[model samples]
Target: MKRRAHLAGLLALPMFWLIGIYIFSLVMLLVTAFWTTDPFTSKVKPGFTLRNFEQLVANPAYLSTAVRTLVIALAVTVLCMLISVPLGIFMAKIAKPWLRALLAVAITLPLWAGYLVKILAMRVTFTDAGFFNWALAPFGITGPSFSITTVVLTLTYLWLPYMAVPVYTAIRQLPANLFDASADLGAGAWRTIRTIVLPLIKPAIIAGSIFTFSLSLGDYIAAKFVGGSTQMIGSIIASNINLNPPIAAAFAVVPIAFVVIYLLSVQRTGALERM
Candidate 1:
């Protein structure tokens, strides 16, 4: 009884800290959202109102930018899944341990080499006279410059490894006997995969998708650097922070909402228990 109580108290400590930070931040935002600056005095007036949300809703540009962020985030998430799923299966199901290990290392090592520098390298190759265009110039394939495409591609490169790692681990942990049993029962490769493998690995897919979506949504640096005029929620919040704290708070909360909902769904699905 005493042990249970002590453990409960210990667990409560971090939860308390997290709750305190969230509540404190929310309160500050509520206060600042209502604050009015005196015209002549340049002093802040502590009050309450709904001007921030009203302004956010009324501004078409803000709404459009938010939509663009969600669209791009969805695109990135889908692309990561499409790329990682096959790669993870190949790496996990390969007959040789050395081959699997080499592929795993290849997929993972580039992640630690600094993401910003990778974005810069991508930018360098896309320049008109850069290597990519230089190679294509001889083939007479030229077109207008692209910034949005560059940003999306850069983010995909950055997050593909994150998606691959989890899916690979999930696939590797799956029982080898299950595959053999299915084959012995005259199940084809695709049939075995569809019936036995997919359900087991769905949890990993969920995890990887959550990571890819959340990271891409919350990321400020990549959106700001590669995204040029492609305004996203991150930059929107940044712009509003000093000038309009309440609205910025609202913008930041959207991503937090996504993360919380995803976490709750994962918990309900017992997805993380396997991890």
Candidate 2:
């Protein structure tokens, strides 16, 4: 009984935070999604209606924005994965200690800066007369000038550390003998990575992907600063949040649903356990 009491006391604050704060907020948001607004006064009222959801489904603009956001999220996740795997391998197994430390600092440096600061930095880089254009002008090339491509790149820059750190740690934890054994059997670097490294580190990759993907899905600030006229799911939610809050709430549920679906799909792989 004493041990059980001690465990319960230790768990008290976290359980309260999880249930009282996080879960309560989510429940409120879900409840708000089904609510209605007064047409004349624009005030929220206590009544259930599916009209907001219907609007989301019927509105082509909303549908397109959701699809575009999904694409951008997937693109960022893929880019992070592609870059992280090779970078992690080099940092973990090949780079000298000093170089590895330097690389680690470089990867995490962006996280130290403020979020808006990073977005503005990307904005400056891709502006019409910004560094990107100035540098590429000699080659007769030009910058993308704040398009969906720029949005994807900005998001990747912001979230790369989340993906890279885990992948690098996972790779570092791999038994060194696995590589030696594969080499002894005449397997090349690419072959060894394909057969061994990738399979072992997949959980970490998935764990990292969850962060990048969900963050990209819900981000509006990056798009607002560096996306030119690009619209994302968060853009719609922000626009409607004041003028039509029920619609905003309903739209907000889209990203939540996508994340829940993604978690469900990846749960079988034990990725959530890693997180």
Best by lDDT: 2
- Candidate 1 residue-wise lDDT at 63: 79
Candidate 2 C-alpha lDDT tens digits along 39-142: 88889997889999999989899999999999999999999999999999999999999999999999999899999999999999999999999999999999
- Those runs of model 2 whose alpha carbons end farther than 4 Å from true positions after fitting are 273-275
As a whole number from 0 to 100, the lDDT of residue 43 in candidate 1 is 56
Per-structure clash totals for the candidates: 0, 0
Deviation from native of the Cα of residue 106 in model 1, angstroms: 1.8
- Residue 61 in model 1: lDDT: 76
Distance from true position, residue 57, model 1, in Å?
0.9
Candidate 1: regions farther than 4 A off: 1-5, 26-31, 34-45, 135-145, 259-275
Candidate 1: C-alpha lDDT: 0.76
Q: Cα-based RMSD of the predictions, in order?
A: 3.3, 1.2
Encode model 1's per-residue lDDT on 1-275: one tens digit a residue: 99999998998978777778877867676567666545565455677667766777888877787777777777888898888777877888864899888888889888889877987777677667676777788789862334666667777888888788888888888888999999999999889878998788888888888878887887667666656667778888888676656667656666767678768887898877865
TM-score of each: 0.82, 0.97
Top-TM-score candidate index: 2
Q: Candidate 2 has what TM-score?
A: 0.97
